[model samples]
Target: MSVQTEINLSQVVVRQSQKWQQLALGLLCMASISSPQYVWTLLTKPLLARLDVHLPVLQVTFSLLIIFQTFLSPLQGKLIDRFGAQRFIGIGTLLTGASWIGAAYSQSIWSLYLLYGVVGGLGTGIVYIGVVGQVMRWFPQQRGFAAGMVAAGYGMGAIITTLPIANSLASHGLTQTLVEFGVGFALVGWFASRGLRPAPNTDPIPSATLTTGRHYTPSKMLKHPLFWLLFFMMACMSTSGLMVTSQLAGFASEVGVSQVVIWGMAALPLAMSLDRLTNGLTRPLFGWVSDRIGRENTMFVAFALEAAAMTLWLTFRHDPLLFIVLSGVVFLGWGEIFSLFPATLTDTFGSQHATSNYGWLYMSQGVGSILGGPLAALLYQTSHGWVPVFSVAIGLDILTALLAVVILKPWRKRFLQH
Candidate 1:
């Protein structure tokens, strides 16, 4: 064999190794950012107590955390596309960890809002979009599964921390818990992010790839009807998940199970841990299914499953055992948006401007937060029951599931054919 042949083989092996290494690093970075959003419900009661703020006002801080994390994603996506993933992820992680530590020392409501709401939102948004986008670009051949694994980091990462956070808050107080976890998140995120790298995209894709064999810039992608279909579909489904996630503790308490022990564990914390695991698992599971059966097909199954879960949850919600079990199913059905939609977007639009294009798609999450968080909360208040809130979410899930086949499948085919 020629010496040059050996050199080429070595280079290929090294690049493959680095690609997987980068994936692992991205996963850890996402995990570090998970607590701010996923664990917010745990902090609300304490935050309200220390500040003596009303529920409606305290909920704003939570809403803004999601809003900033999502609404700002399009801009952050473009920035990641231009500036690269590692830098933004590193900086976002620092701010996210610091936001917690800062919130631990808040002297007033507004100060807490600024630290946990504004800073937390911006920081998580940057890292969330950056890591997922980077993964999609890196593993175009396995876009769905790759995006799922990274997203799973965000969803599942909290599982390891939920019980710990609850225990910490119970024993050490909220302030110490925040300070200690914040320091840990900061260090882990910083170290992991140092390994981040965007996969090279120099090779031309084949004409028969899942994409349209044409690329669209973020601006051009907006003009296509297919993008809007995806945007609305995502908004509808996102609303269902976010409503449940944001209000779990409240609803669990109303059902008289938040503090009830199930095998020596508080129902709410145990539920949170279960939900996180299912949420994390669903992303990759459905993403892998999408890679084989197609994105829209998997969406139909997952969305319909969530719709069924919501209805059952509402029916048996008064029963603590059913509530805990059904909540995990709901998450398993819902969390794949982080996987499916981005993969679909790249498949439909091409990956050249995937980060930027997906940014716009991600903004639907912000929209969902508004509808899911405050509006759903208001409906529960006015009706003085959870029926109305769950009813609305169930409707959205069903509609989105039907549209996945009835609308998205046909429209996408036409879009690609043309």
Candidate 2:
């Protein structure tokens, strides 16, 4: 073979190796950050007793963390783009871990808000958006599947630690558990963050698969109508998942669902365990499907499944067995948003500024947290039932599913042409 051909093959091999390494590192970073948001449900009861507050009051912290994570992401994204992922994640790890340590020592509800809500939010946001951007840049060809896997890490990462955290709250107490795990989260996240680096630059492939050949800056992408539609759709999707995430433990107790035990495990913890598995699996599973079908097509099926799952969940919510099973189904349908939307946005707008562009899109999740967290808690307070809340979530899920095909697909195609 010619020396030139050998050199080209070597370059391809090197690039391939880098992509896989970056992907794995991103997944580890995601796992390191997962417990803060994902396991917040397990901490709610103890926090309420310790802080002596009503449920709605305590939920504000959850909303604040999401708010900080997402509302500040555009800035965080720009910084990551400018400074590099390693430094960004290093700082994030310190904040992420320290928030838990701080929360461990916190005596008041307000202090928890400052620690987990504000500081933790910023930390996780940096790592979350940064890793996603890395995945998109590395696998422009398989953006959906690539983003799905890393997002799955965030979704499923808690699986390994969920039962342990629950057990610790019972055995060791929340304070010690938070302090110990906080240190672990920081060390693990920092280790993973150091490995993160941007994908090497390359010319656009001659057979490029991007629907739009044009690259839009974050500001321009925000101005586009399609972006707003996706934003609203995202808010809907996020709300459904967030409501289940933040309110399930309390809501289950109210209805006496948590009292029931199946196979010697409490219903709430068992459901949470199953939800973690399904949530993590759905991202990559549907993302791989989208690579073959289409983003909107996959969105339709997944969102519809969530709507159906919510419907069934509400219908049989009184039954602990069905409740645990359906909660998993709900998460299975909903978790793919992290993968699909970022991949779709990168596909639509090009990866030149994917991190920043997604930063703007990421804010919709904060909006969902407000709608789903404290607000949903308030709704339950007023109506004194889960029916009204579930009804609203089911409606949003169905609406987004329809919009995906009817609006997103055609509009995306036309936008690309222009």
Deviating ranges (above 4 Å) for candidate 2? 204-209
Tens-place lDDT digits, model 2, residues 1-418: 9999999999999999999999999999999899999999899889988999998899999999999999999999999888788899788878899999999988999999999899999999999989998888898788889999999999998998899999999999989999999999999989988888778876446332375457789888888888898889999999988988998887788768886999899898888989999999999999999988888999999999999999999988788899999999999999999999998888888888989999999999999999999999999889989999999999999999999999899988786666
lDDT of 2: 0.90
Please provide, for model 1 over 243-270, each residue's C-alpha lDDT reduced to its tens digit, 9 standing for 90 to 100: 8988999999998888888878888998
Give every collision pair in model 1. none
Q: What is the TM-score of each candidate against the true structure?
A: 0.96, 0.98
Query: TM-score winner among the candidates?
Result: 2
Clash number for each model = 0, 0
User: What's model 1's lDDT at 130?
Assistant: 90
Model 2 alpha-carbon miss at residue 13, Å: 1.1
